[model samples]
Target: MKKIIFSSYLKLKSAPLAFMFALLFVAASCDTQDDVQPDSRALVSDNITAALKNNNWSAPGNSSAKERKPTFNTLLVALAKTGLTSTVAKEELTLFAPSDEAFAALGLYPNNIGNVPNLEQILLYHAVQGELYASDLSAGFVPTLNGAAVEVTLNGGVQVNGADVILADKRALNGVIHVIDEVLMPPTLNLVELALSFNPEFTILVAAVQKANLVNTLANDGPFTVFAPTNDAFVALLNELGFPNLDAVPDETLRDILLYHVVPGRIYSSDLSTGDVTAANEDTFYVNTSNLTITDANGREANLVPSLLNVQATNGVVHVIDRVILPELGN
Candidate 1:
């Protein structure tokens, strides 16, 4: 429900630098709200029957292989529908396979969702370009075949974009399959667009961005991580700076401060650690994941809101913070 469009970091050991999108800081259910009520299980069963006809359908596993519950019935349908079943069976790629329940959360089943826009792209968002096992997964931004990146988190347990990996390192003919809990929908907007979409929540943040003339910069194909402050945070900043409103703040100063909130990569909450994270302003801020707080160069600390973390956008990632990070002014 917190719609500030922000990003953060938790752990980053080392991995391939693939980028995904920044999130629009809304709850997942809100993002998946559609007109149609969830389709019945009978429809899902029908899709599975149709998908079974695709001989290329080898994921979840061949019957001769390890005998499991075949939980990926819906995923199998998606892959078969896209002719991606053959690809998953033959290609050396990694798939974060979501279960039927994951798709059900979006009111999607194989047959019912055949008309969904960009179905192929949505399926591709769940895959990477190479065969990566759980061991190969380091916490960082990993580019998916969809041309966007997915966030990998190894902090407590392995999580992809925020979906828990209930099962990991399931081998495929050409790649690995990791069963995940949620279906990750690709981000549709960039940082600025995402913020503006939330209206009054980011009204002040969006204003500061426009006044600073950073709309285009933030909207560009950046894989940037923005530790966005809430509207309340901006108000608190105005009180701290003894200013009545954002208009009283100088442009250069606002720009500098805003820039300080942005880091140059797609850092997820899992990638954050206890260290100095340099911002886009060429200044650095300290993050302590232990306390979930960011300390700017001025030694002032801002807490990352626990619930509003790791929202993805088309060009970047976003983490909603409770305070507006400050950068030193007047040298």
Candidate 2:
């Protein structure tokens, strides 16, 4: 089994040059706002120090660190537009505040945030119930207020759902703020809905779930990691068994086969290693992300399709497998 061990984070002393300009700008003009570079990575680098201020947000009328920190002007406006400034002020919550440059990337501005289809859900996806400091941030899924968990990876850097956390551990009166490079979107669809959305590709898998009467199980109750087999894999399995179609397979056997592909959790590719992984059916398989292969209990191996990995859903994550490896079943 691959043991998930979260190590202590080593804070980088030298930050990028952009946020450094904030300290100099503090001396130059504390009252003036500098021209923000509207680039993707620049989103995190620009005005990060300013974002680290201990603002309770109770006082939004003045230019104070304890009031409205200038770096997060875009975020502040978004909160105000959503009427969530008071919520951040009183409720002890964590805000994964995206930079102004991040908003600019999506063509969003202080005046046009209403253009977003679901602004509140998008905004709530960035905030969690309690303070999640840099130290407290571990490698896994952390549930957001929008009812979806954002995946966190601390390997190369701290990334929340692929957005880099450029600045972390900034104090706030009500909670804390972690400046991210990009905005986070909570998944609107569950696993079944997501699979259905990708119509042709997941058609057979969807059909199999329906056949097994596990549609509701896959749809509603999960945080599951599904290593799904393609239709070609199912066809090959049928040919190997001398069966004409899915209808020829026994219901209990099909259920066991479907359950063999699923694991109970939102496991990402980073969370995998070269070791045994227990499936929902109590059968075990060996996964090696190094070479992208999974060896089933029956000794048959299938390669994990890298191009189709980590397709996120509201209830879980899905990774495509080339072959449908089976458990040891008596003929």
Candidate 3:
């Protein structure tokens, strides 16, 4: 638990070099766009000033910070509290700046920053070392300063850890900034606790797990891979089983079904191939890479939805499946 105590942000005085560079930047723009460095190094050296500007550093559009001062305030205050303001202001970094609405969506208020446990970890999770412009990113795991990795998917557009990159390639003098619409949460909870964090979607699944008394087993200490089913998926299961709800299923039967959805090790979406992986139920599950599908023991197949894939947890990984996996009773 890293406690972040707030302090006043010591302003760095502007240097002649910064003004000289800003003038040079305008002059360079008259030539060709390719001639200029495609990052924040082209802007004023005073990052604190650059971040507060209305227009983005390099991006040719309105800036997120300009639109939502409060969100920027939240982020900047966190950096100042952690004493990382100078590091971001002077060093090379790539920050995924979340929008004001993003923090609101996560139920994070301006006052919540100091009270949140591992507050520094959450802020550091958004930053990566070196200058990474939007064009420099590729679809894979990006290691962050928080010592955990965030997955970047480039199928439709840029997405980091399921958060859509609303605005990309905003340059800052000290680093680069990309505006994201969702907060990239760090893996602070175990599988069970993490699942509970997303209420309503996994409400039925949570209830079933609790009823089975498998909370400890799932949350104990695991590098487990889980194929979690959403609420709709559980409803489908109840209908198929002729039950009114999850509670109507026998405890042993419910436990077996839930166990069937879990794999005993960390398996990410990128690691999938056409092969057989054993589930926690000791039953074989088939993985098909060509179509990105997972097949259960009962011959039921669940396609891995891109939007719901590769959710990281402190103890392991979780992927949301469209359907609930049921094990063959005899097997």
Report model 1's TM-score to 2 decimal places: 0.65
lDDT of 3 by residue, 1-331 (tens): 0111111111222446686566556545644554455542544455632473444433324553544432465666667777777777777888888766777787776678666778788877998999887788988878687755788889688999888887776667667788888877788888998899989799988999999989998997677889999988899989987899777888998888888888887777876779998888898888888988888777888878788787888777889888887788762
**Candidate 2 versus the native: TM-score?**
0.67
Q: Sorted on TM-score, highest at the top, how do the candidates line up?
A: 2, 1, 3
lDDT of 2 by residue, 1-331 (tens): 0111111112323656675555455544522333332222323432322333333233222444542332566677777788777776677788898877788788888788866777887888888898788889888778787766788889777899999987666565567677787988888788889888878877888888999999999999988999989888888899988889898888889999999999998888867888999999999999987899999988898999989987888788889998987987788
Report the number of the highest-TM-score candidate. Answer: 2
Q: Which residue runs of candidate 2 sit more than 4 Å off their true CA positions?
A: 1-93, 104-115, 128-167
Cα error of candidate 1 at position 117, Å:
1.6
- Alpha carbon lDDT at 218, candidate 1: 96
Worst 10 residues of 3 by lDDT: 1-10
TM-score against truth, every candidate: 0.65, 0.67, 0.52
lDDT of 1 by residue, 35-55 (tens): 223432222322222323332
Tally clashing residue pairs in candidate 1: 24
